[model samples]
Target: MSKTGPDFYDDEAVFATYQRHRQRVDTANDTLEKPVILELVDPVANKRILDLGCGRAMIGKEFLQQGAASYTGVEGSKRMVEAAIQTLTGTSGHVIQQTIEAWVYPPEAFDLVLSRLALHYVADLVPVFTHIFQTLAAGGQFVFSVEHPVITSCDRGWSAETRRQDWVVDDYFSTGVRVTYWMGDIVQKYHRTVEDYFYLLQTIGFQLEHLREARPQRHHFQDLQTYERRKRIPLFLILAARKAI
Candidate 1:
């Protein structure tokens, strides 16, 4: 749940539910999303990083610890901003409490820009991505992750029965706003196809570098069943693009 201003995460109950979800081992964020995102942003040393929708800034803390020159996070939720500040304590990192849509991007200021599971919450991507391209120095990388179209295409609430079976990827070609339940709250998310993402980046003048479906890996999990079940469908779509040098 990244910043769509006035989002469910701002609610205490939803925030508490999300914290508990993150604490559980083998969740998608830990086993699937984080590793892929880190792999795409390797060799963080000496790079200026800008994180959009940074929740708790946990990864920003890691980047700073790995010798990133500086870290800046933009978040809309006050609670998330406070948590991000604490997570980045003792490091040369800064956080700005603002929505990605509203943040004033500084031109050519960062070597890398990242967002995780956040863009889907944004209704308009062109303006946001244009800002990302403008803020990054030439050859800078932009890496991000979002809920896969298969998951976003349908809004059926999740349940134990559905968890054990294959997902129904209905209306996959249709793209628009979706209302779904997550973290014990109803949230609005935008649905876009894989081609839509690539097209937008290329149209925004970002050279495509890498695209991943957040594949399952053996080391990411301890249970064979969990690993096998994860292979059934792609949970996330990750992309890495670069501003031409």
Candidate 2:
């Protein structure tokens, strides 16, 4: 099971129990992911976009509404592709049901590549980054978000049951597969440190442009206690990198 990934998430139960919330960007994602990635990439008019692990392809709709030239979403689940298709009908976008790990990248084909809260699930990231590098046009930007290292570093609970509010972190620097109990069931996510990600990107011929560990606004959050706890630790890491022109 160590070599396996979370059993190809095609079922509805898995979708509900998986990472995404309410078929859209949830609090943590909207807070830490959207703002930072948008600020860096700015997917407006005349840009061709590629989305990896594109769940529901909701961003594709926003891209089209913003007058983007085109959008292609690669998703692993057929139902996710269906939802994306339903959401993206009559728009300049198409969702392909395929895993990003196996999908071939079209060389220098896209102006912008985006992945949101998806990279951690894959066991290896080096080849994927290489593909992203090759698929982007000169000066093209790749913006993505992944689960925070502290969050993925350990599975130990920070629950009230343990009488602890502080997160438990272990084996932080060791890179390997981690099984996470999220939403409801067990899911697999590979753990990678900040230095590991930075080194991979730099070695893959990507220039770092922006990096942010963001948090939600207090006013926007209703649960003060949960918000306070989250404020102390980041949930997501957003990054933007460019292929040299």
Reference-based TM-score of each model: 0.95, 0.89
* Worst window of 10 by summed lDDT in candidate 2: 1-10
Provide the clash count, candidate 2.
Answer: 0
What lDDT does candidate 2 reach at residue 32? 55
- Model 1: lDDT of residue 241: 98
The digit string of per-residue lDDT tens for model 2 on 152-234 reads: 99978654234346788899998888876555446789899988888889999999988788776665456776567667888
How does each model score on lDDT? 0.89, 0.81
**Model 1 per-residue lDDT tens digits across residues 135-196:** 99999999999999989998554563245375778898889888776666677889999999
